[model samples]
Target: MDHKRDKEAVLHLYNKILPPLAEKIYQNLTEVTPLFDDFHLEKVVDTWTKDRNTTSEKEISLENGNVQQMGLRLRLNGFQAAGAQTFDLSKDLVFLLEYSTYTVGPDKNTRWLEKPYLESWTSKEMEETASRWCEEIIDEITQKLQTL
Candidate 1:
């Protein structure tokens, strides 16, 4: 299998999906309960989760990579229905994309933020992408709001 393709597919998945998904969330929320706009769509709580397992149990080598994942963090709080007298809703909209493995030592070359990546993800690159995605999602949300 082509690991390089795997890496590119990962990038595409995040870049193309997150912004629209966020937009949909806001749209759906507004459709269901617009009065709680003051509460919904507050922030994206960034969090990373790790799976303590190797890719293959048969390949129990020290160099084998462990499963690490970056999850989408969106939380809504203080939401209530139009007729609710003493009720609030808080929800976590987390999207776990893919579980990645980081192999030790030199491996194939991958491009991230116009730089090379071999073993693990690039922090700066991922940060930049997240910033861009935030802007995009916000832009979409604003557009949808203006229409409403």
Candidate 2:
């Protein structure tokens, strides 16, 4: 199997999965569509989420040409939602979501976000994509809380 092709396919799959998952949350929950204005949802919420976390350089090799690998980690804390009386988000309801996407293939060349890379996937892009998905899930939960 071609490693580069595999990596690209993974990223593309994520790009496809995230938006629909978010939309599903919204459509099913119904109450969330009003949290942000259409403009706010499209621009601010989406764009801000894009900035929530970033890829960090894990390591680099000098002896051979290896660009290293990295990923993003994020935690949303102290989120409160309104139920019938206002849902209180706490550590238990804390929803711990961890995201990671890695390059899978033979040789060091099969690394995501590696410079002079063989794979077409970038860790940064993958991180952002994962975050977007998480945000959508959170938004769905938030709406559920509001109506409860």
Candidate 3:
């Protein structure tokens, strides 16, 4: 397989699929938690051959709250080229979600109360499957965050 072709295919997946999905997940999270209003979900695509990865991140800092800082990271991986005449779904794709929180200190420094509350991965084949997987993951994350 041509490395260039494979790289292009990966880039295509990043540009075409991941961003919209990330946005949808972000939207869902925002709907469930008003704290999400203080932060923005950022979708980053790193196509560098040696470090090919896609990530979604959100960080928020609040002045006088139990949760002074919250960070969320989602990594997208396991991309593979489909066989001829096969549907191009993110079947091989995996999403790793990590959640972090910090507390405000007396000196106005943020202390790591809980670095990661949740860490999970989701894998699904086909467009619909992948979408449902993402939605479920987002729902879980939202539920987890509400307790924070």
| Per-residue C-alpha lDDT of model 1 across residues 1-148, encoded as one tens digit per residue | 3243133544443454445545555554454444444444432322233334433443321122221222244443343444443233343333332343221111123212321223334454444544554454455444545554
lDDT of 3 at 50: 27
Ranking by TM-score: 1, 3, 2
lDDT per residue as tens, model 2, 1-148: 3332223333333344334433443343344334322311110011112212435342322222122222222223333334344332211111111133233221224332222223343445545444454455566555756576
Alpha-carbon TM-score of each model against the true structure:
0.38, 0.26, 0.32
Clashes of 2: 7
Predicted candidate 2: what Cα RMSD to the true structure? 12.6
Relative to the true structure, candidate 3 reaches a TM of 0.32
> For model 2, where is the 10-residue window of minimal lDDT?
39-48
Tens-digit lDDT track of model 3 for 1-148: 2222233333333354456555655554454334222334444322221212323232221111112212223432221223322111111123221222212111223231211222112332233433454565555544544544
Ranking by lDDT: 1, 3, 2
Error of 3 at 41 (Å): 3.0
> Judged by lDDT, which candidate is best?
1
Winner of 1 and 2 under TM-score: 1
Clashes of each: 0, 7, 0
Worst 10 residues of 1 by lDDT: 103-112
Q: How close is candidate 2 to the true structure, as a TM-score?
A: 0.26
For candidate 3, what is the total of clashing residue pairs?
A: 0
